[model samples]
Target: MTTYKAIKLIKRPEPGPVSPDIFEVTEKELPKAGSGEILIKQRQMSLDPAMFGWMSPDTESYIPPVELNTVMRSSGVGEVVESNHPDFEVGDRVMGMMGWQEYALSDGKGINKVQADVPDETVLSVFALPGLTATQGLLNVGKPKNGETLVVTGAAGSVGSIVGQIAKAEGLTVIGVVGSEEKANWIIDELGFDGAINYKTDDLRDQLTKLTPDGVDLYFENTGGPIQDLVVERMNAHGRVVVCGMIADYDKEVPSPGPSWVPVIKKRLTIQGFTMPDHFDQIPTLLQQLTPYVMSGKIKHRSHILEGLESAIEGLNMFFTGDNKGKLIVKL
Candidate 1:
């Protein structure tokens, strides 16, 4: 093909569901792999809550915002169709920041070869950003211990689900807070979470108190909502809180208030916020810690996939609505 389709950020998104007008779908001439570069035909791309931050006008975020009229930034799995890079070769599967396009040309700065014998969907859902985030936040930051209680918000989501499962495997009492009954059941029954609280239907304080009779020891914060304050209040002394994504307030004109620091002071808690970009250099080590759980059949994940590249525009709303069952991917 002489050209490929790509979506560019024409305008910054407002504080609500993403409007389609902010993105411009355009066709561009396909570029060849220049010297020491690789040409990748992206197979599937990941849709994450992090995209909201990337598209915003926030210049001080962990990573730079996507420049206006440039390809919307994202990560994806692709095949190296042509290559001049020494490490990458034609036909090799790879994953990296390929953006919101079908074809990407890389100088091999951030791209890495996919050596695992798993489907592309599995790679994006488990081994990519979601799994990496879970490992770094829960294992490294949370430092969960046996018999302790862990309450992870967005428990049915890409990162949260994996975090709960890893905690379960590590002998923690895993309780997940979800939005709907189906998600609650999936995390509790299928993913082996000790219990689940439906944030929309349940009394946050009551359910959390009943479920975590011993008090929570590790709090993996993925969604900052009303339940966030309740969970923090129930944390035991010396408890650790791993602050990941805050999806609940991502689209708000004014972000919601966080939990009070009184509990942190009284309980001697440690709260830390992390983003993947800061720990990208430690990917190899994180994978080593997370792989054993996957190999032992402890970690499980599902993909909520969109059909075409254009579908990504609407699929992002699923994060706010809690409509997606698991990891969100755009199959291009």
Candidate 2:
């Protein structure tokens, strides 16, 4: 049997100087698909900010820690080579919550059918999990209305960029917040947002006051911490704040706190945090609305596709440092 390389977490360490040494790659024999199982040859893997939180041993979280000597947790697109499941077939392209391995054996639990004809890069770009996350988080939760102001942090990212575009499609005045002027220009000029604020340079409160003169109606909160605090205070009456992922504090040893939201009571603001699983049933609906726009070129997306599975760590680092624009995916 031939063995393949996999990035595995060898230890869980406290936040310390030595923590960087906790993860390593190792060769492991590829296992055969058992009955009802499908074997996947991973082509591209997603490196998200949330994966950093899952590496910690102390925090109680949505997913468990990657056990010592186990492959790191990641969502990836793969081609099925062997299948014992009736619903899946050999040569089927799929995406799922798999580990950071060249090959994976799935029992048909987390895997979803991916559009094989789409460019291999696009599967991990806008059509797969990142797209769904943005679509579900923005359209379903945001419910942005025509002429209303929709604001999003991480505006250049896969989720936020789509959120901004979708809101624009719905006739909302989209205001995007990103870390760089280059990203700001891309969001405004390329993605059709009404305005883009370079959060790294601008004073968010004053900028929001000038840009969203009527106050924000829908705030798609992606990066939390100080930015979140500012958005909360600037929300209009009956404004909705959809807390997606908090990328800002994800890699921190100590999390940053936002301003007290008790004032939201008097302002009649609606603030809610959600994960994709909360509205799993909405996935098909989101796909129906988004896929057409994507196909027709009405909706567009970008990705930073670095080559090789070894680049996954670098992708994660880019995500943490806000260096990546659009979705960050590593090709295997």
Candidate 3:
């Protein structure tokens, strides 16, 4: 049997406080690939805020809680080391929900054979799940129009960063909301956002009103909380909101109270929550369309790369603390 190391959650540790050692690294034998299956050696893993919700012991989400003693769920880029599948070859480069392990065996299900020539980092970063979520949500849900006003929360993150730029490319006035002035400046100055607000200090209502005098036509919400409520208040009539994620309440025992935006629904607004898997069929279209923009320098990225699997805990913590400026990736 082939041996491999994986990061597993030993228990659902209490949310409030913890030691540095949150996850345990354990070695195990790689499962043998069956017919229609493949074995992969992981290269890099995407560290996402969604992991926070998945780690909790709950039934509220569509995804079930990660059971104790199992590899932590995550997406990664890997190379096929062995395959018994007709569609795949041994040297294929792939990206999928391979969990947090050095080696993973898959049945070639829920996996995509990434273009071999694509950069390894892009496979797990901009062109992976976050990129698809951003492009699809903006196009399908947001449905932005030229000269419209668009606002994105968690603007420096993997999803929000791309959403802002894509909206800008569509000729919308893009306004970003981030946790720090540095992030705000990066989005506004570097990424071509029309304006940015530091949500940590700025009065959301006041700043938004000043930034988007026309009111918001699209709300790409990566964070849900008081910011969501504030964004709803400023939304123009018949606006659309894509609920991409809710990173704020992941660690709390009781969920933070959702925004009191129901009254604003009278304006004929559309708000929807979505997962990337629900729209996986559109990935080819997404990649074909986005790759050009990315290569042309129309799309920009900021990533925080942590070294080694041992630092995964720290990298995960950065998501919670809003410390990461862009995509948080574990370079193994």
Candidate 4:
């Protein structure tokens, strides 16, 4: 009557490169919901590239670091199995920073109500951080304009994929940069992007020159590395760069040098870096703008969902390795 499975961060990742061995799933006694708190049985946990930063030692960031032996921090959707709060009901489903545990004890701060009938995939992809991130970073930061040439790195990912489609809807040309031919085709053919370049196999400069003949007006940067430098080089005057993520350097012990700022001055580029926590107040506006495209089937998404808490450790590696086809989530 008392125990449930949950994953905990057993140790911090080392200084140079990191591995998934830091996590361990174990049985823990369930905690009773006190007055004004609720008990939630988690259904799904969203996997993201941001975990890299979270696994490291504490730093000034949108969220706090995961202490050793604590439930690894994560966002999840769950149902209220028991409640001691006035606002929440026993059957109500909600989403929030529920971490990697099978059940969460919450006082209802960041949690939000979720429709029971809505597919978990949709909730995890478009409505969660992925979709909100794309909306906030691209619309608020990138500021896409009609007839502009838009380039997105990690274009096959949750945030980048949505950004490309949204830009297309707004009357801009969308070009995706992915790591494979299959992903390249998926973004262009399935996701309606105008063009796609395979960064791993294709000649980077050649493809950028051919595909972006007009130069990039807005760059939705997701992965940082040589690809980022190449994309920066192809940017046009007055271009905007929306810094969403940098999966390329996630595993590196020592971070590499970023793209030079000389181009920022010469091209007069606007470069902005953002994390979702700072923009939480804008979720409603983002959802209002993103809902129509999602309902109409314009904003398509994919996911590589792993089952159970055990896979949680392995599933995170997918983001860094490009092994996951789409959004990554751990289905409980």
Q: Highest TM-score: which candidate?
A: 1
State the lDDT of candidate 3 residue by residue for 1-332, as single tens digits: 65778999877756653344558898898787898889998889888888876777877787888888788999989899989999899988999888888888998877888873667777666889888888888987778899999999888999999999988888999999898989988998899999998878988788989998998899998887687787888888898888889877666677788766664667788888888867777788888867777877788887788888767876777867887767888888
Off by over 4 Å in 4: 15-20, 115-117
Rank list by lDDT: 1, 4, 3, 2
Error (Å) of candidate 3 at residue 190 is 1.5
Q: Give stretches of model 1 more than 4 Å off.
A: none
Give me the candidate number with maximum lDDT: 1
Q: lDDT per residue, candidate 2, 1-332, as tens digits?
A: 89998988887745432344677978888899999999999988887766766777854676567787888998889899999999999999898787888999999886888863687668777777778888877777777888898889888988888888888888999999899999989998999998877877988778878888888889998887566777777778899999888877666688787767675986798787877755555666767877976887766778888788777755667865677766888888
Using all chains and alpha carbons, the TM-scores for the candidates as numbered come to: 0.99, 0.93, 0.93, 0.96
Q: lDDT of each model, Cα atoms only?
A: 0.93, 0.80, 0.83, 0.87
> Per-residue CA lDDT of candidate 4, range 140-170, in tens?
8888999999999999999999999999999
Residue range with the least summed lDDT across 10 consecutive positions in model 4? 13-22
Stronger candidate by lDDT (3 vs 4): 4
| lDDT accuracy of residue 61 in candidate 3 | 81
TM-score of 4: 0.96
Report model 3's TM-score to 2 decimal places. Answer: 0.93
Per-residue error at 57 for model 1, in Å? Answer: 0.8
RMSD of 3: 1.9
